[model samples]
Target: MRSAALSCPFALTRLFSLLAHDQQLRAYMPAQVLLNESVERVGELDVPLCGQLPNDWSTWGFVVNGIVTTIFVCLGIVGNLYHVRTLGKHSNSRLTRYLRVLCIWDVTLLTCTFGFYGFVVISTGYKPWYGDITYLYMVFYPLCQVSWTGSMFVVTAISAERYLAIARPFRKLLSEARSVTKICLLLLVAVMLINLPTFFELTQVSCYDEETNREERMIWLSSLRLNKTYMLIYRIIIYPLTVNFIPFITIVFLTIKTISVRRSAISRSQNTQSLSPSLPAKQDSGTTAVLTALIVKFLLCYSMPTILYVFEYSENEELNSRLIDISNFLIVFHSATNWLIFWRWNVNKSSRSLTQSFIFTKEEAARLTYLWANTRPTEVGRDLLYTLIRANRSLALIFANNPPNQTAVKQPRDNATTNGHLCDCRLSESSRSPACEHNIQLLAKVDSHGVIVGIFCDRIIQRLSSKLEQQAIIDEIRALGRIHYSNRVPMRNTDWMLAKQYLIAKLVKDECDIDAEDIRIVNKFASFLIHEVKCGRTCAIAAEASVAYGFYPSSAYTHA
Candidate 1:
């Protein structure tokens, strides 16, 4: 060996360069080319994950899926937990509040079964600790598929509750907590048992390869018939349809019914005059809004994946691949957006206080009200707010619109004062049409000039009085103030208060550019304030000033 080293023609430096350039070829270097042949061959042996853990980019499949599973599980757990805690504190009706607990249970199963088990083996190259016969068969797998199906069943249950509460108003027993709880639990158990086939097919196993350190994929190589059947049921039938389709359709149906019931309820109340503003009205209104927001979001976000899964399972491998990728990505967006939904639409001070007293205060929740109030009318805000308000108003009409017991009517008190009333009369729209009499009528009373100004568009100062017509100007002002304070009045010009001030100043000082468009802006702003503000006196003054001055020419106003 020593003599061969001396006889080598090429220097050690040259050998190193060749080896560096072509490490793979170093092992195969012929005896003729190199004097010494004892160097261990690089290409002769395969490298395992020990070589590099596949680097971050190469194992994107594992890394992405693993990370997604972790994040989704975390968020789902956190959100469901928050709901449970909040419900425990604020829920007066045990039956209605049970849904929160059920939702948490379902999401917990999802995190454990779908999120945890699915990602664990891929991440660690071993069956999850609970994949043994006891956990997998007895607990995890069965619970996962069952809970998943139960989630759909729960949605259907919620729909049924709505249908009963709306379509069959007499069926109060149907919405009772005991009945709902028994039904939910029984249905959940049935769903789980039905899906137990999933557990029967899964098996814990170990394998060896050159790349022993690399993460393993769930290769469906076993020849067992049950395994294949399980795969079919999971990938094609149950998971796709139950997780995606059933819930989506159920939510859509519930939303429509809920809306329709609301409209009907509101119409029935049109004849009533006194605004007692019952507690049932307020609580129902708030809860209904939250529920609708939650349902709509569930419908919109979850539908795509369900539809995509259906498409993926049906065939078209190329299409399936693309759809799967898109579906996976969308799931992340779906999970993350829940945090936003809770923060934005579900922030009532009463609810917050209830949550604080009953459930431990959550930092995320504490900041939620502030975050929501301070949020500008940007993406998702306006749409969410409109949907919530509409939903709550409908709920108000449904429960609050119930007819008062005729038997409870007492004789008129001696001191009762009745205003002049008009008899019901029929008016023909045209000579040919059948006429209908109004059930109740109002006598023509002296009209306030202020009411006239608020009612019609005078195009000038008259428009300013419209704010007086709003039912709850004080509440609106407080809400606006809350928003302003929450945001620290980031900019005076941009702030709602400051903006209103500037508009008012331009009208009062006469040191401002006033145009026809300015008058229109003023009119619109006046109209909005009429609905939005709580100040009748302020509205009256503004209206008087505006009617006196009329309006500035449209050309005088310039776009900011």
Candidate 2:
């Protein structure tokens, strides 16, 4: 029964061949001899369909694909690893957590698609499972589809999350980490189920060729009626709609909504500021810029691939093949470039003390002022400020207790290391004021707090002294001035001044009992030092004043 079932197709193919040969013979005969023939007989010839290779296998094509895949695999691995590590450290925000998961998905998808395909291309000169019903087709194809679909779904989820964050911050939808995790898990399962048909839609068949007297094996869709219908629906409608059309629509809509919300926020802020002329308008330009860049890159990378996949069943086989290759390349490129995007836009640089100080110099100061003026005080900012103050105070105490020795000091002449003394100030023979001497010891502790303050002050002075423009300094001062006024609870001083006063108080409190007079002295000293620094006094003058009241300055300074 099985043999008969297999032979039926070949028998029909032979009958069709004979009919075609007879029809050709009739074509050479006179038209009058065939005048009595029925119209259907001459209208068309029925042809038997046979399984065949999807394309002519090319060695060059396989080689190029293999090389490209290898490059992508390496880049994807390295980039995703970096992204995971970096983002893991800053996963406090909802967007950051989503991004971390997105990185994971990208790595998985790239490995499943390119890594597996690369191995196949290197081993065989054919693509797309080598047109066989092997493990590649039964397992790998479905796995690749699931990964691809899951990635697209995750991208859409990210865009939606951004929209909610920017557009509807007050809404409680998927705001919790647990909710996000649940949704992601559901999306993964849904995508896997959607792609499950891939495993069964394709199969291997034996084709008997009478002319060649041989049996050829080919990979194709199963001939069962239900399977054929399912394949047609999947190829023509379901896959394209699910993977491309819906995802593209969702992402575009969410991105546009997010932009609109941002613009509205900016406009509202400006309007409010206009009403209160003294208030500064704060625009979240950083967030807007990052989102815009991400949207543009996403469109560029995925649009062509989506279009190609939607029309993949077109009659133009060669055109479709080329498009598939191009789409695959684009997918690889997209996966590989995500790490760059995250690094450029998503990574936080605010945790490093020296770098944060440098970054906050001028424009950041203005931004902070604008933020405070336009928006209500946020606990997050306040907490961060407190954290910094605590860290600095701890550092100051550590150095005061464990001062570096003269022999251990290097670069004593550097503004960060000495108060105009080229030699290690600890080794100075001349008597010095306790204030000046303490400042020198503080400077000697470069590994502790001096480096932080020095780098910040140096960058500030560099930017302020540059010939290009002074607007940056003016903006920073304006922002600092606002901070000084609005911080009613922390004393009416700039954040920097407040930090200095706190440090001075900490140092003085340990030596003597806390008292109003002591507080007054510390405040006075902090004000004088800040004034000197702002007035463009050299590091030496500021250091001298910082330690001047308690002791005497040396008669002569020595160079290290």
Candidate 3:
């Protein structure tokens, strides 16, 4: 149950084995001292884990164990608490739920590591008195095992869920809130059962403390430590497998698969875009870089501990002890500061690909552009982009509301899924005029997979004088884009790319000086806005946004 020592349940067995041959704890004691631990010769070594008069928080051991470690634990606790509170337990996003639970478990691990094993016994210069420390440590041992193992499983669950979201998208196993919660809870119970035997690892015995020169109540290694079968199966095999090996393999596998799938999708998207040169071709490299860094960190930090758990140094106990500290420190640092890693990378700078598609795949983004050529009042798909034009209230004024010069041609595509009508949602050269409400146009090809790769949005960047104006326009378009999509299914792909081949022709089209970058920005902003708006927004917010976008003229700029 020595987590700080990479959980060597066999260490106690090793102690007993040495005792049988008349080798004592002090006989083979290393020059180095331990943190929060006590030892004695054959008989005295059976004393409690902690000394009665433990080092004060401000004592000599305080530098490494007192305020600094305490600060780290406190930060970890507060940071995890912040995540839990900020990401509500009932949030819709499955990622949010996973992160929230992860924060909870991380907090537990931090609390236990700091609480029970707070002070370090750096030196053996002083003869410390042994007390009843065995029962308390054992009581919290199960809790540590639960939290430590639980955190790993939750992370694996997250990786699996994300992989499913991209690779399958239709699977609901780890996608739903209730299902995810149940899965997390089930993992907790499994780990608890696995560590259930550790609850009996502590033994109570009356031992004499040389320093105090009196008999003291001590609880150390239990009788079960001598059971060969129990030691081999329970401690050597089950504990390490549950805590490190299994989770490490799972996360690594899922991450590799996810990256492979992502690369395949990107390759397909690039191929699709090659046929249509106008379509925007942008990959979210930022997400890739960030995820790769995180995965590398995980592999490096957990690799040592996983190895040391199954096979400790049989001959060199000192080396084993040193590795234990190193492994435990790595684990502690990784788990506690995860909040910072996630926030620094994910929360602050989100992937621009999200603005293009809900699935955040390039292939999907290419498809979405077709379904959303442009509806009445300038829209992409079913969403209303904005109330761009003002209507006459006094009179029933009617306008042609120009139809985009859409030319649909039947074309056979490379991919079977992308074989359908090729749509061009732009004004013909002859129809180009200044009166058009939207000079901007889009061109796309359609298959059952929505837009696939043919759709190309033509946006104009000339009207906006400053970068702020362009951003405002994009923001406004996103704000007004809050509308329900009919063909959206929770699991299955919708049939709409070819449902209305004529809709592309029916869309409003014009001319613009905008390029591919502008189109990508528009799509990216649209995607970012989709996740933020689940409900309706007030007019005040709308007005504020409009002013920010310079849609409304200031008093000084307004003319009579």
**Number of colliding residue pairs in each model:** 16, 9, 12
Candidate 3: regions farther than 4 A off: 1-68, 89-91, 120-129, 133-135, 272-295, 312-318, 346-560
lDDT of 3 by residue, 408-432 (tens): 2112343221111111212233432
In model 2, what lDDT does residue 415 have?
Answer: 40
Model 2 TM-score, all chains together: 0.50
> Per TM-score, what order, best first?
3, 2, 1
Measured by lDDT, the strongest candidate is 2
Residues 333-391 of candidate 2: C-alpha lDDT, one tens digit per residue: 77777888767764554222111122323443443233223322232233323334333
**Local accuracy of candidate 1 as per-residue lDDT tens digits, 1-560:** 11111111101112222223334223322222221222222345422211112222224334444555566666766776776666545433433444564556546554644433345535563222221222333345445445546655665666666556656643332233445567867876767665655555434333212334332222111233124454455545655455556667767877888878877886775443112332334545665676677666656655655553333133343333334444444544444344455455554343431112212123322332222233222322222222222222221121122332321212223322111011111111232112111212111111122133223222222222344423233344334434433433222211323334333333433424444433433333432443232222223333334446663212111100
**Model 2 score (lDDT):** 0.49
lDDT, model 3, position 367: 39
TM-scores across all candidates? 0.44, 0.50, 0.57
In terms of lDDT, the poorest run of 10 residues in model 3 is: 387-396
